[model samples]
Target: MTTSSYLTVKALTKYIKRKFDADPHLREVYVKGELSNVKIHSSGHIYFTLKDDAARITAAMFRTQASKLKFKPEEGMQVYIRGEVNVYESSGIYQLYVQTMEPDGVGGLFVAFNQLKERLQKEGFFNPNFKQPIPKFPNTVGVLTATTGAAIRDICTTINRRYPLAEIVIYPTVVQGENAAPNIVKNIQLANNQQLCDVLIVGRGGGSIEDLWAFNEEIVAQAIFESRIPIISAVGHETDTTIADFVADLRAPTPTAAAELAVPNQHELIQRIISNKSRLQQMTSALVQFERSRLKKLQNAYPLATPERLYRPFIEKIVQLDMQLGRASQMYLMKKYNALQKLDSTIKSHSPKNEIQYNYKQINHMTDLLTRSVLSLLQKKKDQYGANVRTLEALNPLSIMTRGYSVTYKEQQVVKSVTQLSKDEEIDIHFHDGKVQAKIIEIHEGGEK
Candidate 1:
């Protein structure tokens, strides 16, 4: 074969590309498949493999198309794509250049559901701590659903059946379609603002994923999370779950179940009340009986039965105290009398009357003694005087003269010597009886003369 006749790898690839480009079916091809080996580029291009059970095809979506996607594509995600199928020349590969993409069937919704759930879970929006406790017996239940939907009817009927006392405030809202999420959020806010209901049941009846998609929306979930009142999520059948279910304070399998959760069964409540009343009656009767028994025991007690006995000991004690007081008073008086007697005796002992009398007697005796002493002394002195007088009389010159002896005197002095006389001097001669003056005419010397 000629060298030009044999096709090169580039030529073969270009030929395939041209064939694909020429085919109108391949130009705007629609495909449904599961995504695999997904790669999101920094430039916002998505590269992945579209696969079914039997085969797979490489696919790519540019930034423009990828930006339009409402949900992120991931591995094993089923998607419906409208795009051009062409062959690349570089690696000689055939691939789909996706222009538009959407999730296929329930798989897309599941992806969105899982993605939002994971996101909210990470943000703690679904945390149990943020959940408010549903009232055990709500006085009012606010219903958020379509007015004509079976969910509202079920909720209302169920609540009425369970608890007739619970009032129902209905908030007619669109529970599906694009407007559903915003409407639900608005209703939640309105209910909170009005403060009309104690609890809220946000829900709808059974539906497909697309039909129930509003309940899965982030805004609906956020509204439930932000509600001040407790929310019960009753989105669908028992098998169906939504984002509202995770963020709500409580999740019920159905709207009827939500109503049941919101209120207590009246029959059961009545039975409980009856039981409690019986228990209270029995307890009160027992308490009264116990109190009566206690009172009877008290009444039979010695102090209570005979109240006088209670004070008898005190009365006896008072009588005894009175006797003791009397005895103490008598003893005190006697002691005072004794003290007075002693005081009188001491006063008498210290009395100036007796002392003065004794002192007077002493003074009289001393005076008498002094008088006797003075008399004796006087008598002795008188006797001495008499003796002295007698002696004096005996020694008297007159007496001597009377006894034939005389005193000679000169100039009125007694002359003791014979020389006392001078010739022609005046002299006095004295005797015991008289004295005479005379003139001496002669002098006589004594023995010497």
Candidate 2:
């Protein structure tokens, strides 16, 4: 085959992309499908897969168009897309270049409203505990709304008619369209920074939901939530609610109602003052009468009427205490005298002359005991010495010799047997009193020769 008969992958991809781009039917198409694998890049592009029951196609939404979207695209959300088909030359894959996307069965705005509401609710933005209480009587009231509108007129007229003392500070704001949300947020923060108002009334005249969308923005809701001054939200006619209504410190049905809530009615206050003044006068009169009666009772008291009656009990108590003190002194003196007499007897018993006599008696008794003990000990020692002398005499060899037994010695050694002596050996014999020397004539064994 010739080279011209075959096509490279790049050539094939270019041909397919050209076919996709030139076709009028594929140039701008509308599709309804469920989203899958949705990815919102940090660069503001969204990449996702769009699928119905039978088929799916890859899709990409660039940042410029995506920024215009009212609601965020999420996985599994059924959506309608108006876009053009194109081929990705790098991978030879076809994808839909999304231009505009909206939720399939509902308005995108409604979806966005619910999504933001649920998110802010979870973040505790709508908690009642964070809500500030509106002032019953404000010195200054701030109005945040369109400069030329019935809302401003109604608020100013209502506040002036009800509470004339309160000063009104009007902050002109954009209450509709694309620039409205940021403008409203700016005025809210500005009023807070000025700190000029005791309470702020933020509202606009009733309109369609699109005309009232500025109040539903998250930034506006955050601004209302963070404001130090209490905010009364009058967004629309009674039935229309916005995110600002939920986040504000208080919500009013209309601008006039918000003004009434901000400050108390002057006529009501005057009537209340008159009623309280009458009640206070009655209370003061009753209190004065009660104090006068108490004074009269105190003046008529028995102790005050007769001054001497108050001190009589004290004088009697002093006399009784004196009598008790006298008795105590006499008892104390008597006890001291008895103790002195007992001490004198003890002193006499322990006299030095008596102590000396007792010592002499003790010396005599000790001498007698020592003499008896020494005599008994001397007799015991004498008996023991005599017994020892008899035992020594019994063990003496001389005594044994005297009993007819004698010891024979040869060469100064005692001869125990006849083998100790040889024939004609000289020998010595020890008797009871003396020793004898003799010569051994013969030797003997077993007493025989």
Q: What value does the lDDT take at residue 319 in candidate 2?
A: 100
Best by lDDT: 2
Local accuracy by lDDT, each model: 0.89, 0.94
lDDT of 2 by residue, 255-354 (tens): 8889889989899999999999999999999999999999999999988999998999999999999999999999999999999999999988787897
Clashing pairs in 1: 398-431, 398-432, 401-405
**Model 2 regions more than 4 Å off:** 301-304, 316-449
lDDT of 1 at 96: 94
For candidate 2, the 10 contiguous residues with the lowest summed lDDT are 440-449
Which prediction has the highest TM-score against the true structure?
2
lDDT of 1 by residue, 96-194 (tens): 999988787756567778899999999999888898988887889999999996888888899888899999999999998888889999999999999
